[model samples]
Target: MHFSRVPVRTLDTDEKSVAQFGTEKMLESAVLLADSDLDAVVTLSEEITKATGLPCSTSTLAQVEVLKKYGVKRLSLTGPYVDGPMRGLVAFYQGLGYEVLKTSQMNERNNVVFGNTPLVRIKELIREADHPDAECIVVACTNWPAALVVQEMEAELGKPIYDSVCVTLWKALGMVGVGIPLFGWGGLLQDDPILKKMEDVLEILLTCCAASRTTLRLDFLQKNCHVDTVCAEACAAGIAQLKQILVQNDLANTDIPPPKALMDVYAVRAQMLAPLVRGDEIYGWISVHQVGKTRVWTEDEIGELREAVERVNGILRTAGWI
Candidate 1:
């Protein structure tokens, strides 16, 4: 595998500027990895993929995926960040349906100081952030050399350790279809059956829906969606419009008229959307779209979609993502 590194300026508080930096710097790579835990920077994976025609992974997304693979619901977080960014990380995890039981930070803003942090101090921060109930411990920030001590920390703490750098590499390698056995880093590098089960569930959804595309859009992560098929710009716009309509009508599903944008822009003739709800909260929705020609959704087809939702919800609950 070819490897290269391009460094950017420190993150801007403004998300637009961060996105611009990502799109500009992430070109000409077979697979892109945005090495930042900030939501603004990490959430640009989809956008970067669209622009560069390459798979993209971010530090935040990689951490989340690792947690999902482990079925980790509760997290303890530590990082070399000030209170604001630390809290942002907590919120980001909570928004994704993970319980952040505790957080510890260095309260440092200097990236140079972040990198200079001693391994002993890093271990202390991880211990301070750890909660008895937290299923996993996440050490955030790619600049810090946390990866060097993750395996040791995990052994000492007796739970999974996810350092930002390690998880990013794990996801990046998987994206490029390279399976090099990574050891002495963390448990995330190992194979797990849960990941395969999640893949199979999505595959079943596509076959049951009989639609051209199926997407799972989490409300908190509006810019990114887990899709069974790549959605073009027009299809993405249509899905956004459909989501808006679902909200406006206070409906559990989008069984209403096709969004004008779906028909006019994307030639999307038929669509079905169902909310993935766990009790009172609606975290996200599953959408199936049929393009080209309009077709009425049959009762059997709708039933099959609902059944798939139930099955997915069961899997999510088991995986601690709900």
Candidate 2:
């Protein structure tokens, strides 16, 4: 459905702008959105729809008054907001001389609230739907942020959720339906026929890896510096001069950098994986970052960071992210 997201500002300039309402400035913000393609406009439940719904603004009661004035009988009555506010929304809609079509019993404060499951709850709500007389469910209040959850709710409820945003999307997707599967909101959009297949495939790929979560990325260096390489080789050569010293310390080949570099090639990370292999075979793999966030890498934590990148890449490839 047409999901409408209102905007909230953060403390910084990078904050994303959205269509929102809270004060007179917010109400006047509509002029900015006059060219906006939003399907549903949201406002307070008690405030007159004449401002939002009818342009000049009118209350639900006043909206009915205006509709009656226009000889419009088909009132797609919705509301009660999430938790139905103080009273039952069904009663409120009935009071407006229109039939109650759908009610999500939603948590009305979805816009700013993090981690609310409008999808899961509405899925449960639609199971009890029964519509016989209304042309369409008016949906709940606009501010409820039920747009994403509406379609899946309708698909299951055997009737529409009639949300403002969802209705707008319903009108937009009239005959052609979208197939992208979203996980956070919009109920069945997360579990639609096609989305389930992809998520299932993605899950399987992830489960097939046993890599450490420490990877790194480095730049595409042209080659090892000649001066640095000469220095490194000379240092390794000096290890022989102190062979007696190493043996005295119970450390063999300890004076050389060659062995460490080989064991940790380019300081790359190695990960031993126990994937769900077809047989009992396991794989030990090494990976190179090739590019990274920083210009030069740090000496410490390099191995672990490199390993994490390997792990992530393997998972992505297995999941077809490559």
Candidate number of the best TM-score: 1
Question: lDDT of each model, Cα atoms only?
Answer: 0.65, 0.35
Candidate 1 clashing pairs?
none
Query: What is candidate 2's lDDT per residue for 40-108, written digit by digit as tens?
Result: 333333232334552322124333433354354343443323443414555765666665554444444
Q: What is the TM-score of each candidate against the true structure?
A: 0.51, 0.31
lDDT of 1 by residue, 39-72 (tens): 2222347866675444566877888888887798
TM-score of 1: 0.51
Query: Cα RMSD (Å) per model?
Result: 20.6, 20.7
Q: Please give the lDDT score at residue 110 for candidate 1.
A: 68
Instruction: Please report, as a residue range, the 10-residue window in candidate 2 with the lowest summed lDDT.
Output: 241-250
